[model samples]
Target: MSRLATLIDEGNRPVVTAEFPSIDGGGLAAVEKAADELRPFVDAVNATDNPAAHAHASNTSIAIAMSQFGLEPIMQVVCRDKNRIAMQADIIGASLFGIQNIACLTGDDVTAGDEPEARRVFDLDSTQLVKVASGLAEGHYLSGRAIKQPPALFVGAVENPFAPPLDYRVMRALKKAEAGARFLQLQIGYYPERLENFVAGCVEHGVTRTTALIPTVVLTKSAKALSFMDESVPGISIPAEMIARVAGAGDKDAIAEESYQLTLELSRHALSLPGVSGIHLTDFRHDGSLERLVRDLRIGPAFAPDPVASASGTTSV
Candidate 1:
């Protein structure tokens, strides 16, 4: 099993995961630099696929690079760019380089990217992709053809508990878990009541028993970032009051400080939840806020190692 899998199974401490900032340049050196920043604070990091419909490094290559650099990567595969065959190939190919974690997502529409003329491919949605990834891990293709040796993949998917049709979010989570998602990285949300109900529903329906629920919290430096997300980001919704709180906090430095505090509060609330197994961080600030937040919460592989079982052969995230 992967280190992340081992930690999730043991349920001893919170598993910390993060997004490896999309690499657009600097070759392998860029990947290394970003990995160094995140590796210490996270158990595993995601190599996102055409995030927000914009393209950069391929998910497979970034994931493979992260693995070589000693940072375990959750290879993110999106349905918006490739056909089912290509997606399977990316997952299988990354596994050849020791990439074990796969996070399936239904990417944003092509219209959301700079190159709006790009073709949009929705060969399969998120849940179907999860089932397909499970098939690959189990030693077969979707055609049911067998593999000589299947790669061990810790499969997972993303969820938006704060989105509309709120009551159905829990059911969606259960569906993903049943489809073989070992974990679910929730979208960044500001509403604690929604998160509370979402976690509770997961436990009630038995989603949390087998799968890890990792909620996402972003680290941003200003209120403009929050406003941008609230107005433009598709799935993320920030209450007007949250934006006002930071905006009304006075000058630039104070606004930034307030933003950090808001994030810290969210992190603490997430950690205190019972069925919650981990946290996913989306970093928007290069300042010391990331380190400070992790240090303050005292949750992550950098803070401590798992004492229950050392099967991971590495420190816990």
Candidate 2:
């Protein structure tokens, strides 16, 4: 069994979840390769789509592939480009196909995705999406309709900790939780203090348990990519010094090694934080390097907190 399965079975124990990029961005074959690389320690796989992948909703192949690999799947369904009917159908189809975990997202704008010409259908935002999933779990449809059996899915939602007014993010998470979000994943983790603050904010909102996603950057700190990051990905800051550090490495392999090492260091920092239920390893489409990073670090679920340490009441970022 994978560490995730053991974590789940161990009853509320912290877990180490990894996100698997879907073949929709590259191809199914590429996804398979990434999966094979991460299979060693990857507990649960969250399959996401390309910015323009709303049209490929019919391509549920990733879920099937995950099952074939004996990996638990947390399928994400975005609502920006799908109407309620299509959303409902997809939800039911996913449940029928044995997808147990679902992440409801109010997807980004069409312009934000790869498909600019595609019209969006925001008939239901994340809040409504959560309600829909909860309703399905209760053996009912969103329209006051009933079903033969409720789907048994672990509903999840995402939050951006760096977003303005952190309180608003916490409030949104609370709404998701009220709407039946069983797990919460954050998108900001470049700094250890930021992660701790995010978790503390979650706890303050009465969230006793939620999965904290630690974002791992895989690209080398080259000048070209650093320039691209500044121009294209807003709110994504890669310091020049960090880039210079990577660029100053002995060679390309050394650069990759250092980047992965930084990721592992961040992982270790996140593991030390309290209320950090788990770490989500994100490769960000970096040539299957996450596999090597996990193996080298021997990454796994967080062990039980030491009572003696708790008595000392230690705290850090």
Candidate 3:
């Protein structure tokens, strides 16, 4: 089993995950540098698939590069650009290169990207993709053809607790888990109460018994960035008071500090939830705060309070 798979299965301490910055330029040297910076702070980082519907370096290429540089990658495969056949091939291809984790996503609409004219593809939804990946791991394709040797893939999908139809979010997570998603990386949100309710419901409905829940939090230095996500990002909503709290912090440095504190507070609260297994971070503060956040929380492999590997759902609160 992969370290992440073992960690989640053990359910001892908190797991830490982050998104790798999208690369449009720079060679392997650039990928190496990015991996080096994040390698010390996260158990595994996501190699995103055209995040926000904007194209960057291909997820496969970036994931392979990340592995070459000693950073484990959760290669994301989106259904927006590929059919089931292509997506399955990508998963199998990535596995050959030692990619152990796969995150399936129902990507943003084509209109969300820079090139609106690009045709959209949704041959399979996120839940179906999760099952497809699980099939690959089970040594068969959807067609029921057997593979002599199946790749061991740790499959997961995304969930958003803060989005509309709030009560149904837990059910959606349940669906993914039932579809064979081993983990669910939640979408970023500012509301603790909402997250609490979602996690509680997951536990109540028994979703946590089989699927690991990893809530996502963000590190942004300014309230404007928060406001932008609130207004522009789909499936993400932030309370005005939360934005005001950071905006009122005074100078730029003060605002940045306040933002970091906010993230730490959210991370703490998320970890405190009974069913939560870990935290997934989205860093907008390019200013070394990623390391700082991991160090402060003492949860990731490098900064954990204990030298031993932990998946105990216990984090420093």
**Candidate 3 residue-wise lDDT, 217-284, digit = tens:** 99998999999999888788899999999999999999999999999999999999999999999988
By summed lDDT, which 10 consecutive residues of candidate 3 come out lowest?
A: 308-317
lDDT of 3: 0.92
Pairs in steric clash, model 2: none
TM-score list, all predictions: 0.96, 0.80, 0.96
Clashing pairs in 1: 16-317, 43-317
Residue-level error in angstroms, candidate 3, position 145: 1.7
* Error in Å for residue 283 of model 1: 0.7
For candidate 3, the per-residue lDDT at 271 reads: 95
User: In candidate 3, which residue pairs clash?
Assistant: 11-311, 11-312, 12-311, 12-312, 13-310, 13-311, 13-312
TM-score of 2: 0.80
Candidate 2, residue 221: the lDDT equals 34
User: What lDDT tens digits, residue by residue, belong to model 1 across residues 1-317?
Assistant: 78999989988889999998989889999999988888889999999998999989999999999998999999899999999999999998888888999999999899888999998999999999999999998999999999779999999999999998999999999999999999999999999999999999999999998899999999998999999999888888999999999999999999999999999999899888889999999999988777888888887976755555654555665
Q: Residue 162 in model 1: shift from native, Å?
A: 0.3
Each candidate: RMSD? 3.7, 5.7, 3.2
Per-candidate Cα lDDT values, in order, are 0.92, 0.64, 0.92
Error at 185, model 1, angstroms: 0.5
Model 3 misplacement above 4 A: 307-317
